[model samples]
Target chain A: MIPTIKNSKWLPLCDVPVLDPSSWRQVIVQNVREGDRIAALFGCTHNASVPVRLYALLARDGQGTLSVLCTDVEKDYPSLTPECPQAHWFEREIFEQWNIIPQGHQWLKPIRFHAPYASSTKTSPPIGEADFFQLLGNEIHEVAVGPVHAGVIEPGHFRFQCHGEDVYHLEISLGYQHRAIEHSLIGGPNKRTLPYMETLAGDTTVGHTTAYCQLVESLAGCTVSSPLLRLRAIALECERLANHIGDLGALAGDVGFLPTASFCGRIRGDFLNLTAELCGSRLGRGFIRPGGVAFELDTSAFHGICERLTSVSHDARSAIDLLWNTASVVARFENTGTLSQAAARDLGLVGLAARASGVKIDVRKDFPCGAYADEPFPVQWGEKGDVYSRAYLRWLEILQSIHFIIDKQERFVPNAVQTQIGNLQPSSLAVSLVEGWRGEICHVGLTDDQGKFAHYKIIDPSFHNWFGLAMAMRNQLISDFPLCNKSFNLSYCGHDL
Target chain B: MIKSLWTRLKQHHRTIAFPKQEPRLPEKFRGLPSIVQSRCPKHCSECVTSCPTDAITMKDKQPHWDLGRCLFCPECSRACPHGAVLFTDDYRMATRTRDNLVIGPKEYGLAQPLEDQRRKLFGKSFKLRVVSAGGCNGCEVETNVLETIVFDIGRFGIGVVASPRHADGLIITGPVTHNMKSALEKTYRAVPDPKVVIAVGACAISGGPYIDSPVANNGVGNLLSVDLYIPGCPPHPLTILDGLLRLLGRRYSTSRR
Candidate 1:
């Protein structure tokens, strides 16, 4: 879906007089009715007390599209959850994080924080972790599954409330891996933080770092050259290829297909080799700088990439065909963890997870950023948002990306790298989204009065889809969680941040 | 069964046995930090400005390099008119001493190149463990591939270990994060003492790009005493293999390991 664009020149839909950045007064008080939503689309109220920016989207219409924020609910504020069912989680997150109370609010259970306060919350004083997530009913059976699993994966905890095999209620308790990234950046936020951004999750190094650099470069008013944009796209495509291969192998492995699994894994290594050959580091780290990419792609390396691409593509196709034709693999993946379109949108899911459910919202296609803006490719969408669909969609994307790289490599020519960047104006706020291998990755940055970053929030595709994951798990046999989870392949550290 | 065998036969082995044979590395593959004794610094300040991260500082007229901060892009060598910054084939660059890398012009402590040091350390045999603490999974990916049929590191008795418990040395990637503090420490503790910690990649050697993390008290420096410092966001696969051999004393420690 296209992003609803609204000009901020005129008055905002929000009721509260948008306070200037320096001031903290002018709080408009409004009481929310049982079905009333307070949505704000144009400009959000900056909670001076917290480091976060609050924008409300009240659902005045009965339709799925939410409304704008209506009031500045502080001491005299009212609860909008009674009016809008979707506002339940967003409000809880804000309340627990920034210590803002939605007067007459219903549920306040901790969502991300384990201890309410890992360190000090300069953004917004938290409402204590204890009162953020939903409180389970007495009839609810709480099931805690892991910070560690038997398969190779990052650490995260999943708690399910069920009435037999079907989920009666669900609450996900995250933060077992909160590294206090935002807090840490407060002290030292230069090149050092760039690589740390990569580890927020292993698979998303390219996506996370790209978003982080884009935010920083934008804050610095630095515009990378076109060649650099192409380079970034190529790097992103490479990272995407590696991930898709691993997933293909992993999904196949789940069904006792070891040869395909091993073959795919070995191909992943070759992918890494190709990356290391072009760039000094393996994971495409340091390749992206503030102004543009740090390294350049010359003829020999370009030829090398081309040679590898040709053979790798052929091998991947055959290997995948073998796995797909296998009865066991096909049976395991089909009809597992299905998430309908309605449920997907309600949870604000993006990326392959949502795409499999037929959501046509790719950051690359919807809001093209980087060289993707120039590349000609349609967003890959699935007819069903199930394990099988998501898996197939990833493979399709990988194929498309390979063609993209081959096209670039064939017609590519080197140009001079631009070293200087433009000075950022403090009055602007630029938001760009990248179609990371996971899904749509959004980056938003608030420049300071001095044009430096005042506040930066990187909303990875994983964050908006976690709830959708819980919903997808409903009614599915517990054994299928692995395949289902792999299909979604959400990054735990990506969300924890 | 015949088709399966055909597929296996048709697939080119993915690994490249670097030590027993020569595996091609990129031209400017920044693997680890080692001093180039060929052209000792005569107190020139050119490299000082060339360092983007300021990991280099002069102490008593000597260049004291914190491998934890030095991203071995070979940019320093590029900046040096004398070509004092050399890319030694020495890959096994690791040590228990946090101050292993020499800083300042005169006190560079490079009696020989990194190749010499590797020869000294390994003499012949070495056991290595590669740790990817927050690696982009690039280093880990290639390193894991090292075990495959193409670039087999095990041919030289070097492989990546998931935990530090069974390792004689440690190879790290990515910048050190606060959450990974316990894990890094546990892995280091898991490996027997008198063991070496090799900082791989620009991040591990010196938080390549993500050095400014809030959780990072300072990337590799705060985590452990990095012996060998390799640069590159993800150091080249062959460079990694060469570093392994250098540690086993199979090769010599040139200037840049």
Candidate 2:
């Protein structure tokens, strides 16, 4: 039986007994096949004599348990991708970071073309220059787009192998925005650390910072006040509301639905404005600190937000409803880019994209933390994994999130905002999973013997779902690529980090 | 179709009346930061230490803040016991010269428009190609906001085009990453001669938080000559709009009566 840690904030890495490499692989493969998703898989090197220690964090959604299984490996180990397809990227990442190869792992490629952490033997290949799977037939032409695009979007390369208008395969190559954020966090909880977490993924500032703060607080054995936790939940849901609204607007824009596109865009700013009212920044930066929150809401400020939220919610609902009622929008959305439920499960997709594929997994509901533990939100899913379902799922989530925010506002109690965070426990590991607007944002922090961060692993939801976007494009029309892409709206920098 | 037309008509003119009137910013919105030199204690490094981006430096024993490099987190303001650093709601922080970004005790003016021949050539209609080398999508989204109904930058005859070849200038964002260095250079080269590069946000000016990172080359300033520097962690849409308008020698009358 794999040793399980109840989802809190931090757990001692030593409490998770290190097994032999073979047993570790067996445990992970068996558990993952039995429904557990690999949350994070990373290696940490401590001493010169000791081998690199590998940690596998498995999130058993049904049980609300996070099981930690670790092993010490010298060079290489048998691959788990053949049995569990979710292990494909994780194994490749392990290989890229430590020079330990995953034997028998098919489709071994660098996830991020960065220099290896431990060794200097193999020079890192240039970004987006890796060998991609090519189609070898007449009429099987390739179309490459970005690290730069027409729209003012983040940089990431997309290679599509197409037969006429129908796309046979699409390979997304990122790492253009890999800012060495994780590497910078080592031995740091310093002033620079929180700022790094805030901008880890700019749009998901609250989500990532919350995860980082939670991990730090958990490591320090500190619990924040209920009011602060409630406010954070509200801010997080506000972030959700804004992004979902913006995404819905973007989806409409993709289909040439002008009314919803224009209206939703302005309404999105309204929600962001509400966040600005809470904190100074629209993106919710510097609001979520280590122990708790940086700001507190006064009565007038609180009521102002409540009043603004009501109007924005009404306008947003009206704008989004037009999307469903309009035939042209629905026609473009439905069956455009579909990912099967089986494929979603195989790929280990999370968040809204996963839910759209009928996979009932939400970090907030499954593994409740802070306010979620007290007042949980319902799990919303869609049967069809098409662009339409994803759009509809976002709309559904927007309504639910609005209701959640309004409800939280009514029940909010004024109290101390931030608590004092003590020194972190040495040789401990903390895993924080936040359901960011994009999806599950996992930050795993392992502290050294000196109570400083030894290795920091940040697994953005984009990491799991970017592959799902690629899978969705299979047999899809080339023109619908933009629509399918917007439905996902995966972060380039988030994945790159 | 009639109902849609009526709906559109009822919506009326939704664009913010800028260049004829000042835009409305939220009360809590942070913009230009002003430093009070006298309030700073002698040899106290509180504000300097609290600054995340190292934007604040002590020169002549007075803390000078580089707006281009600032994330505007307000940590320095909170860290200072004497209340030396204060942020104003004035969203006009963009500047023409890099030195102008370093604010001491004295007040600084807005970025002046180009006096070159290219300004007159492109003043009527300036098309820009935006390149996000290593942006976090904050600046990208805000830059996109300029095209939306409320902002609607097209009225000024300034718009973002897809290709650099068809553009008059490049409005670049993000810290230039090593991976995107070649792509950014290639895109810049594609733009015709007499093109200006306007670096937006702190990242594009000084790499923001990711400045000394091995993976990043700080900002586009290192690679290209920046004509205008609009500063913010991610500059508010209004700040960006004002910067663009000011750069074209067009200023909106203040709506305040």
Candidate 3:
């Protein structure tokens, strides 16, 4: 049963009484629009997907609900887009995937990867539009950058509509690194399909793997061994710490502090080594198995790990202190790419990206999974929502993560992990939200004919935050592009895959 | 001023004669895969399955681990619920045979003389740039640590460069993804001719476990010629540093300082 935590503005309106397979959609045509008052237009997901949502808040009027005016009705319900502007991306994404016609929506284009959704047949028809985000500009010169870039970077194309240095309306064209990981997961057995999911993006292995497994666990209505959950969380946090340090160092490097960057990179590298020592895979790739973990952290190994982490932490702290006082490094990140809290929320920014901008929403804290469900560590949040703020918060979060690791590892006993959950029956339908280093990782899973996965959709925080990144880059100089991009550190492979 | 002097003092005695001597490896070091016969469950196929890049293949029923393609992710070992595939503590898997690199029960022997190899490698220093294709990041992490103060790869004249143009050799990591293949080619192309390419980690060498996937692009040499290859999911840092040292013309020496 989907438990109701609290009555929220949107939850009640959208909640289907019972979410059976057929009841995949909660609201019918009449429920799409409330009354006279027009609400905001949000986003929607589609194809290789189940239901197409025309999500709009209704007005609190005669029906005493949130009201929204919709001019164009699909099936006798007033349209929603004219009321809300934010729904544009969702509409475009839906149209691009499922071919749902959003009556009065603007700027319908591809959001995920730039592809023709899937192979089209003559009768079903392929939706073709003239240059989707092809909003033709007046005398605007188009500058194309990267399917391959200069920095140790992922492949993405940024077509900027700029005059000189200042970007006017920026268009981010990513999908160059599409691995098609999801489609490949279908035929294999549960455990065999996992390793592929594990490498969706190397860096996000544990986070994505954890989310994937957790969803399956939830769907199967299976409960994991406690030790396994704790270990998963610990491994995930370590991965988060490692990535945060690397990005922080790289961001500093982008700002021209080579020494600071090198030091941070070195420390981050040390953390990765520690991961290999404890788990055997530096990036925690094989750490997560379908039903539960395959290995255990030996006492001596944990001690060695804690010792190494302490040494690295000390070395990193001294270096960070040096970096903080270092005039050059501090000057580079401050006051750049200022994303206000309201703007971040409005844009649906998540994870550290949103927290950096002052909207503190950590799934670990808010939703509470694994060890975090029991622990009471404070979540680090920043208000400036700028490059510096994000970097600083990342540093603070790294510290918190390290503390969590030590605390968790210290409490771990040998032979504490007893048994596996004998049965991994495919789950009915489940959604697992974990706070990945990047942000909120929301995964939805449903079983297929033979009780295997019918569909599994992962919304990496970067998917929502990519638009925010483009927005953050707006009005900023060309030089700060890498800095702005690094703040988010969105995974192109994870997104593309 | 005071802290700068302290850092300088710490840097002063950070001497490591890597080519002249070997260094310690971490416990979970993702070095080149050496198939241990004693540990193999014999009938288990978990390691073969755990591989995301397909660097491991079963040959005549026994596992044939191609070092040229292994990602060094101890996923095989970790995924071995039965402890069938294991990552041994032995970090010295360097050999002359490209075939010898595909270590399994049949190919676990170390063939190279370290001291002489070290002397040959320490002949000069070389800069390297490490790029990951679709690896689970085991290799990239180890590559990143080559410069840590302890096993300073710089002592062997091996440094990591950001761009391929500045690099004397390219240390390619990960299972070759379709996306990274072009970038790998472009990076190789950008590097001046006569530059060496080193496929570090099992994934780069042979796609680790992900090769057969729709995403992988077979081997590193499938696109570009690689002079030397370091196998491991994330090969032990010292081993990686040692490989770079060997490639820079230094001989590999197992002598401890």
Q: Which of the numbered candidates is closest to the native, going by highest lDDT?
A: 2
What TM-score does candidate 1 get on C-alpha atoms? 0.75
For TM-score, the strongest prediction is: 2
In candidate 2, the residue pairs with backbone N, CA or C atoms under 3 Å apart (3 or more residues apart, or in different chains) clash, namely B19-B252
Greater TM-score among 2 and 3 belongs to 2
lDDT agreement of model 3 with the native: 0.62
- In what order do the candidates fall by TM-score, top score first? 2, 3, 1
iRMS for all predictions?
Answer: 4.7, 1.4, 4.3
Order by lDDT, highest first? 2, 3, 1
Q: Tell me the spans in candidate 3 whose CA falls farther than 4 Å from its real position.
A: A1-117, A120-143, A421-427, B1-17, B30-63, B68-85, B92-98, B104-141, B147-191, B234-236, B252-257
After superposition, the stretches of candidate 1 with alpha carbons farther than 4 Å from their true spots are: A1-53, A56-93, A102-152, A160-171, A183-202, A212-225, B33-54, B71-91, B101-257
Question: What value does the TM-score of chain B take for model 3?
Answer: 0.71
DockQ score for model 1: 0.23
TM-score of 3: 0.79
lDDT (Cα, 0-100) at B193 in candidate 2? 88
lDDT of each: 0.59, 0.87, 0.62
Q: Order the candidates by DockQ, highest first.
A: 2, 3, 1
Q: What is the DockQ of each candidate?
A: 0.23, 0.73, 0.30
TM-score of chain A of 2: 0.98
Q: Report the lDDT tens digits of candidate 3 across residue range A184-279.
A: 565434544666666666677788888877765654456676777778887887888889988877887788876567677667767776766656
